[model samples]
Target: MRRTITKFGSLAAVSMFALALAQPAQAVQAAGATGTTAASSSAFFEFTDGTDTFVFKLTDSAKIQQARNILSGVETENVGVMGKVVKTPAWYNSPWKYQIAPNSVSFFGMAMEVCDASISYVDTHLNEVGGALLPGSTWCPWQSKLTREVTAP
Candidate 1:
């Protein structure tokens, strides 16, 4: 799928991808040599758009750190770009099962915030997602705020 890389997104993606590519062969082998699947390193962030609350599971360590900063007041921005919305149970236990696509996280500070729509709009219009509701499979609640870091089971 085509990704929307606005401003900082491109730089972040490039650097992360480059870092993945630069990993030493030995390191890769050592990871696989264990014969065990990597333990789930996923982190969940619970956010609210005033009325509704939702959670996003982030597997990228960098993105997790960004969320931490936002929650700690270190980051002044309150808006963030969410990943594609899926029709499956959320990574955490909640009435809202829909979640942002994994690894598609982008922090605040963008001219065009695709996920600036409301949570109700996105939930009720799941059928229209990717076409009209949230173009490019991105969702950014304009007033989204990180309430807390959810402990993943």
Candidate 2:
């Protein structure tokens, strides 16, 4: 029994060594990662709902402009990337909302209306950004996405 146990241990060591040699270098770097990824300042919004925060990373100029328009209440139509639906899900021609599984979300609007209207307020203020109907809101500071591509030595 002792001899069999020793042999099995040796075989396990050899298999581990072989597996390590066959693995890609990327896995090693990732495992040894001492760095982290960051967000960019190219134009992104930080949304908050008291409990959680959402970061919308805007890249495309048109989409960014659409977001701007939506915020400004001058957007022609609410379609595709122009909707106020802020979920970090990249689908269709737009990126997804960057929130962490937000459910029971409420938009800013008036009473007696199925959907409240931040539109009227946005139309006047244009640069106004808050969610009265949606409890609380906050403008997050600039942040960067971490780029942790490491060089394995």
In TM-score terms, candidate 1 sits at 0.69
lDDT of each: 0.72, 0.37
Error of 1 at 135 (Å): 1.3
Model 1: colliding residue pairs: 115-139, 115-140, 116-140
Model 1, runs deviating above 4 Å: 1-40, 78-81, 91-93, 111-114
C-alpha lDDT (0 to 100) for residue 17 of candidate 1: 89
lDDT tens readout by residue for model 2, 68-101: 6655567534421112433234332122232222
| Model 2 spans with C-alpha error above 4 angstroms | 1-41, 48-51, 76-153
Q: What count of clashes does model 2 give?
A: 19
